[model samples]
Target: MISFSALGCTQINGAEQNAATPIATAQPDLAISGNSTPNTDSPNTDSPNTANANTASPSADPELSTAIFAGGCFWCMEQPFDQLPGVVSTTSGYTGGTVENPTYAEVSGGSTGHVEAMEVRYDPQQVSYEKLLTTFWHNIDPLDNRGQFCDQGSQYRSAIFYDTAEQQALAEASKNEIAEQLDQPIATDILPAARFYDAEDYHQDYYQTHAVRYKVYRFGCGRDQRLSDLWGAEAPSH
Candidate 1:
């Protein structure tokens, strides 16, 4: 396994620290609104432009389905779903909050009542919703009510933002199964999904675009280590 130096991970500079940091002051583009251009500013920061909302791709394919999940940092949440065979796309954003068009800074500050979340678009025929739920469970610490891994605060809490009654039932069932298996109370929430505001362009596909910094942050955050401890062999590969 590849291991990162503690100094390297802990010393991640600038906007690489966490999502709550205020890195941009510009207005963000609305994904559903469809009014923003691509951002090419600091590679590590969350640029206000290039938002993708709850639905990342503008695909009109009727077979595609959408699911939203909050597993602390949205960056870490993307890789797992992206690797799945049927997943069409993933968007890192804010949801289940009262604020509209919230920025990374505002949502991270915990005042917007928003939590950092990922909106997943997938094909049901290719992959089942139960499979997506399983993947979500393996990647996060369901017991951590405060947050996941090193990131804390309500903005980083783990949750399932279900859009349909079927999804709610599945999510609740999954949550109960996990709680019973672990013999512990599961802290992950199952809530109705609200309007999902796409995060800055820079935040999307972050693990791919900013590889080194992403690794450093992931290692420093102790995400994988905690996952291994929580789920053991069931843990998703990092």
Candidate 2:
């Protein structure tokens, strides 16, 4: 069984107590940007000087790159990529669905064929796509196709939606390498990128908007426990 003590904070936070509370920085520091966790636990606000400022802008830089991934909860996926050094931004969104502009309720209800996903925009000059792939594989449990951690259903299933043929090859190579390393069959899908639907505005920077609740949900969901069991000493501590 997975251990509960691995969680950084075992208590439910203020976000669950009041929606109006407006999440400040995540306490006990569970986030990502340069690594898979940010260096600061400051409340998310719009400012040019903020460390993770680019995650808010929808406008793209021709030079930047994009990768879409579904690793269970969109909330959990954002932090790791956000903290990566080369990552320009991470957007919580939906993709690999038949529906257009699917709402969270519709997607969560399993009627929209949509999965909770994140769009990671990065600078290849700072971080290689291969490195990003490595970060992704380690962060998720490729053995679980039914869902990720506590989130159950098709929408929560893990997938790597590649936007380019090169990405597909890289993802497949990464998947094969992981399988060989673990000596087990990998369940993560390597599929063509689909039309991505940006999630609601409020969902952006959710870890910061609802830091307390994010921690509460993460701890209650047994995410870290499972990750520890799977990755052993190498598991990223979310």
Candidate 3:
């Protein structure tokens, strides 16, 4: 149920002729565009390249570690972990797709099998994976399969890409806690971490660079309102 631009395959199950409604699939769709490499920018203050900043293995150093989570739009997802005390940086990217290196257009077109994701690099000593999980659950509607906010594609579905076994255990614990608290099933998946392709230059730090457009999009998309309805006081404050 994701809206797409620049393609004709709209609404996977539903047959409608419109640009906004793209077909959604539980299975990965084959991408014919072949492999395209994702651009890796050098680390900076606002956003650090996690690959350059930390361990080759995603398990993280005692000082630096990485956590990948897909919660709706990566634009909205980056700021939360970025503002955290020990968080080194957050990068918006794509994952859980069939394509080797997917572009935003390919993903948005529903051909890449990739979903919009955010990678958070943090210091383990200051902030535990548990805290990161807490932030994640509050920010997303785990029960929704249709995607997040105005976006309604499998690409935007919520997921947590855990890099290590410890992350998996903690993520499971957190999900159990949320399920008990909500007394409902949690739809978010705890999948193994995969290669995180950094999004395009313009897509990075979108909240800061495009402040007005970000706010307008956020407001229009109804992300805050939906979070409030779903989380109440538990919702994270902006």
Best by TM-score: 1
lDDT tens digits, residues 61-104, model 1?
78898989999988899999999999999988888887667777
TM-score of model 3 (CA atoms): 0.76
- Provide C-alpha RMSD values for all models, in order: 9.1, 8.2, 11.1
**TM-score of every candidate relative to the true structure:** 0.80, 0.76, 0.76
lDDT of 2 at 217: 62
Report how far residue 81 has shifted in candidate 2, in Å: 0.7
Q: Give the TM-score of candidate 2.
A: 0.76
lDDT of 2 by residue, 81-194 (tens): 887898988888778887665665556667778788889889889998998887787788889978888776788889998877898999998999989988999888888888
Clashing residue pairs, candidate 2? 31-37, 31-38, 32-36, 32-37, 32-38, 32-83, 33-82, 33-83, 33-84, 34-83
Error of 1 at 77 (Å): 0.5
Off by over 4 Å in 1: 1-40, 43-59
Per-model CA lDDT versus the true structure: 0.75, 0.70, 0.70
Clashes of 3: 10
